[model samples]
Target: MSQTVYQQHAYRSNQVPPQKPRPEKTLAQRLLSAGQRMLPWSRPTQTVSTRTAQVSPSQWQKMKTIAPNQECFWNEQTLEGLTGNIWARVYLIFSGLGKFVILYFTPIFIVTLLLTSLVTTGRFGLSDWIEALWAYFLYAIFPASIIWGQFEMYNRSYWKPKLLRKLLDAQKKFELNRRTGMVTLYKRGGKVRYSYPFVEFDCILATTPSQQGLVNYSLLLAHRYSGSMHGVPLGVLVTPHETVAEYYRLWNMIQCYMDVTQPLPDILLLEEARPKDPTTAAYDQQTGRNPRYWRDMSDDAYAEAITQIEAKQSKMSETGPEIDIFAKAS
Candidate 1:
């Protein structure tokens, strides 16, 4: 966070993080960022994104504020895509089942055919027995056909590429590159359909109602002005909150991620990657923040930390520290 963002947090909370030098961007990056800002609908109210100004006990990581964390595979350079486990599980289940049927049932049927073919040469072999074997073969065709299809179509179409997609955690087909400041959407076969600056996306909060009279919140990173696309599924909030601030906090964390000027959002998952980011390492050095603050802590200490964060959540503003994410978009 910048000094202003920290000041806002310090006023309401006890912790005051020291400000560090902002990371320098290359001339090309500067020009690209500037071009993205010139886009019309990119900024309204200067796009103040409320951010949680903490290093440890990240709102999304420590608290169950979101599910299947969007930044599960993030780094100093890029954040690998994350989506629900449904598709990955789908790939695993179908692939495993197809392999089992082909290897196990296939050999059993082949051996049975060989044994039965030998029987045809014997007294049990003649006319009626041959007809019976043919009938059995007919009965086996459906599964045999499937096995043939698996051999014919395997890894060429349908499921193999989808498996690759889930392996990249890209069920949604988008890649966020922090170094390039670009969000690239992929076509079915990993083709780059389009690339836009991260600022071109508008972080939207969606409200969903369930049959049990409960409401759920999720985030979307939709294009600021385009309607051709439905945008990316940021992630869903699983933990219930007394207010909507937690959703905003989730958005803030994402903004913190893509904004190279700032450090990686301090979370347990990203702890190891912090030292890899020059800006983050510098910030940690200046603030004297423990490198393994969350990692080395005892499980009981973590539980107590969680209790403290929850207590603070009750007192947090309806929105967190309001800082203009699109401040450069003038």
Candidate 2:
């Protein structure tokens, strides 16, 4: 057979085969990619884990007034429990003033400078205006800054005792377990400075009779700015309080409130209070230690133990002691 035209054309052509059409990007995918490109600095937001306050055994003993079994809670100190050194307090005072100026006054000063430049129109040069502004800030605003620090100190002193009194009065109502004593939270950035002081209370809420396990709840009495202000000498100051009864009220009146959502401490005491299974009870009676103490046992051993206990329970249920059923029936 002679070489056909088809074979000649195929041998002469060197063009590459077309690739499968690139898959079309979905709208969501395209938008997400665009957003990622636009926000180069953005990263996934992370939860900052806070370290709980650590109390020494002696400190704990000194802080706690009630016995281990009693439900009454008390923290002997007032809210000014975490008073730092004088130098530290001075640092905080200056820091707060600097923050206020940077955040609030800087913008106003900038706008004022711009307006003055526009209105004065060559009556003063930029240097002259800048000098005058510096003078005005130093002479006029500096005193105000000091006053601001003093006002904050005064507000803290005033509200702290009132808050403590409220807590003391509320404590008379229910049996509360002392969760923490005079905890001083440190601000982020690894600095050993006073952030705030708080005490936590844990209470076993009376659950409905139908419920099995005790309802563990906690209330955090912390000092934060209440956003309300009191008129002081120079200016109004922010009030700080626990805000417990304000947000949570009964019959339109302030009432003691407990937080329901915060993670409770591992309630070993409550677990001990719970009625144990017969097998576990027997084991506890023999060993005089909680059955939970054996949680480190091998998985196989644990499984075997549970199985044996269940089997014993089933056997007992099947052949348990009975009354005279036939006589009762007759």
Candidate 3:
């Protein structure tokens, strides 16, 4: 019986092993990978124009109508056709009062002087009435003239120029976003290169109190870490006006990953905050990079970067520059 059992065991030696199961990806990993498509450094990718951006003849016309002098240097012709809404009441108050005094009061003043003079037997003659009338009329005219002047000043100096600047800035920003589209990841080495769009990240970062500060901080962050992160490639998009702030936006993007999924090490932002580089040096010695001035970056990066900035904003700290409400004040 033992010899028979040993022979059976030798014949059963060719059994096949079961195959291992493939690993499944988590939602967080999938999202992070998807978001990388927005990064320019990811890889070369073709983009379809969104057609959301427009610089038509009508836009120029509207720009001109609102504030010609303040309109874009390249699109002055459009502004020439546009007209600003003058505060009619302000004009009325000044010009109307001035005309009324000159036309109606002049005769009354003269008549009162002549009548008073004829009736006066005292040293105080009608000359006093004439002099007083002239003084009162001049005083009234001066104030009215001032009010009119202020109205013109507001329209010319403040309203039109400010509006135009904002429009130009916005147009430039949008044009950039349109050109860049969404870059998620960039892989470049031998033959293959491609970009991926991560997530449609929309965050509002209000750094320090001023837009300038926000711009500075954001840009600095981008400059510090727009390259590879944890061996994974990265790219950034931002507004032209907010390149500086975009850097900070990247820092916050990393922050978002950390808070929600995995926190990046401090080196991602601070990066060994070494001693200040030489003033004459074009790039940092240790980091081997130049400062990424915000204005130099593309608009999509600038906008996205700022959107990711994490501001220490509070009601008490909102007293710096007035937010441009038309542009949603940042």
Candidate 4:
């Protein structure tokens, strides 16, 4: 038997198959990718940490000590220019005359009308007369009031020096300090107009030797021509540190100084700083913590904290002072 020659195939050790070429990206796909990169919200979010700096008790005390009193005054030249315009002077004179007529002559005119009606109709019923008087009064009073307001604005001679003197006297009598004046601007018709000047007076008053730093009083006065034709007494602000009793006492003292016979002005309380626990304070003081870590805190904890804060506020309201300046005088 002939020996069969078996053919054996030899395999190479290092050989690679040819790979197919990759498809090119479409224009739309490239543009979409570029837009995604440019979009603000598409970017990865970064963690941020924020901590509010606590105001120290000493710093608060220093702030109270250094806080200056305010007194506002307009420039003399500006005041002259505003009050001295020929048209403004003419308007002021006419307004004054109109006010006099509305205040003094209107009642007489109404009485005359009532008498004439009675004489003509032989009727003395007050209903018709009163209604007629009311209608006439409304017609005359509205325009007269507006004109009077304009008169007050232009005739600064009565209010300007008087208010300044009052402020000066009050400061000297109360030993109060002045803060920076605040000027407001408004637009009227197509022109800019300056608001009436105003000032704030601040002073620390001690009710008793043992009760030092108990109350802080502030007086706000403004030259308001639109409401009252004279210096408008804004109000007295009483800020008590510990108790509402102190606030009442300080408010009464202010009333006595002003010789106010009417109901006392409203009292505004200062907001108290909330106290934090040691753990929370430490956590807040910590710097460079991942924002996500703080945000991941238990929802229950956040809710509880809010509830506690609200409860504290309610308690404060219950303990705070109640002042109603608008209450009818007894």
Candidate 5:
């Protein structure tokens, strides 16, 4: 019994302790590791900077010929500020003049009436009949003259050069597609076509004093054509050819409204060249000079010719393609 009790006391107390569990990683940690492995293999992004290099005299002259489009937002911005302010000043001056014109005519007309009454009858009437007639004329002339003067002033002052600048500034910011460099003119049936390169304006200010909506429309189309406000006229007088031709495509667009049954045309891009009158000619005796026909060589054509000339010069200097010097002229 004693031997059996001693043998029963044996036990396995040397077993190993349980190991501590490792912490699991989160999704963020896994991603970070994966990113680290792939980053060195990825290609670096190539950014195209707008700041062109400081060019040489010849290169600078050449760059000017490129006609730096509306791509440089600053070009249009400069134009907007300059043109907008100029237009604002012009409009304000004309508006003030218009107001003064109204104020001046009223007194003048009253004086004319007094002179007429005095000339017709030498007697000064303190009678009720004279007083009633005078009151009636005053009442009738006040409202009617105001209405007429307002209409005339508005019609005369509406189409100043600043209006064109305002329109152009708006178009540059709102209408142009900066990526494609295309200007949207009109949209129909979900389809759109733009002017080729820069638009030309033609004779926007050709209108007389009474062409209200038509004049405004022409001014709008002028900016839509050029995307810049450089050549718009200060008054209803003729615009510079440089400004008009810049927006020629948009000028041609006025044809869409030429139909007889169409709505009253608000805008018309005129193409009529000013008649050559010997009476208006101012000559230069030094060179016996006359104004050149700008219509013969367009801005676009001139730009292309310059580009071609440069390309050929570059090619010849580098021993590359043999350019027919004459072929590039056109």
Candidate 6:
């Protein structure tokens, strides 16, 4: 087979061949850099950019190489409200009482039935003990039904109705249109909350240290000049990393997905949607790119691919090259 997109770009981060430190900034560049720090010390990180990512060739290479890391971060059908050029996930962490109902309460009832049946059947006196145990279990359901009714009434009243909607509305989808070049955000009810051209938003990445001192990262998109707290979520990386480059990789991935000049990032989840995006369709036709390259991989090969992507990521710069997003905007 001919060389694939990733194969052509794949270089171990360890083999990244030395890069020189950025040259001293010109006076104008220095002022721009200093301006980002003028805000309060608590001002959020990656919060003062003016344009969306304009991913360079090397950044694209790194992003495509690491694309597998992001495949697990998104879901296909969310809220049943999205289709076409969509990225969505569970927007509300505690969307409803459903987890308690399905995971905890139901499991407890099943386990209790099994355990009581086993313990109460250990032949103690009465010849009809098996029948009696089952009869008592069935008889308990009347009181259990009352308890369930009270729980349901309580769950549906007051503060819970807002949360209960999340059983179906928890998904928040971003309508990223490469053709139209817009990024749309949805509300908890799956209504359009905000929409803007992709270039009008800035990528914001924030991380907090756990008690274990490991840092976890979150990706957000905010209209430029918007307050830090106003950012909409762009999913998060569950795996911990030592530095912020993973944020850049993710940002680059978004850029590739939106840029009409480039093909879509080669990730398994996007395989089916590849042909639907204009630029991706064109590029695939020109290169005869295998649509099933990712989906057809064996489980072991997929695991190895992830290892390689991470290995490339680990040895690279802790922070990737800086781009003056303002300049790109100008």
Per-model tally of clashing residue pairs: 0, 0, 51, 4, 11, 0
Highest-scoring model, TM-score: 1
Expressed as tens digits, the lDDT of each residue in 291-325 for candidate 2 is 45323345456456545644553333212122221
How large is the C-alpha RMSD of every model relative to the true structure? 12.9, 32.5, 25.9, 32.5, 30.5, 13.6
Which stretches in model 3 have alpha-carbon errors above 4 Å?
1-76, 79-88, 119-127, 134-139, 148-330
lDDT of 5 by residue, 1-330 (tens): 222321221111121122222235467645533311110101111111111121233443344344322132222111110123344455456555655545775577567667766876956454634675577457655555665454444334433355444433323322332122223443222233344322222223332223453322123333323334333322212232323322232222221111111111111111111122111121122334323332234556545544564455333321212212112222
What would the per-residue lDDT of candidate 3 be over residues 220-330, giving only the tens digit for each residue? Answer: 111112322222212223333343333433433332221212111122112112122121121244445433333344656545543443233211221222212112211
Model 6 misplaced regions, further than 4 Å = 1-169, 226-228, 235-242, 312-325, 328-330
Candidate lDDT scores, in order, read 0.54, 0.31, 0.32, 0.32, 0.31, 0.48
Q: Candidate 3's C-alpha lDDT?
A: 0.32
Q: Per-residue lDDT tens digits of candidate 1, residues 239-292?
A: 443235555556656666665556677666577778877667888899998998
Q: Return the number of clashes found in candidate 2.
A: 0
lDDT of 4 by residue, 1-330 (tens): 001211111101111122222235467645533311110011111110001112333443444344323121211001011112345446657787878877898888878997788787857467877887788768877778777764554344334455433332222111111011122332322133444322121122222323564433322232223322122121222222334333333333332222111111111001110001222223334643332332333545544544564455434322222223223434
Error of 5 at 1 (Å): 98
Q: Model 1 segments beyond 4 Å from truth?
A: 1-72, 84-172, 187-189, 237-243, 318-330
lDDT of 6 by residue, 94-169 (tens): 3234444444665676676677658877644344555655664566544455445534443344233554344532
Better of 3 and 5 by lDDT: 3
Clashing pairs in 1: none
Q: Residue 63, candidate 4: how far off, in angstroms? A: 38
Model 5 global lDDT (CA atoms, 0 to 1): 0.31
What TM-score, over all chains together, does every model reach? 0.51, 0.21, 0.21, 0.22, 0.22, 0.48
Candidate 1 lowest-lDDT run of ten: 37-46
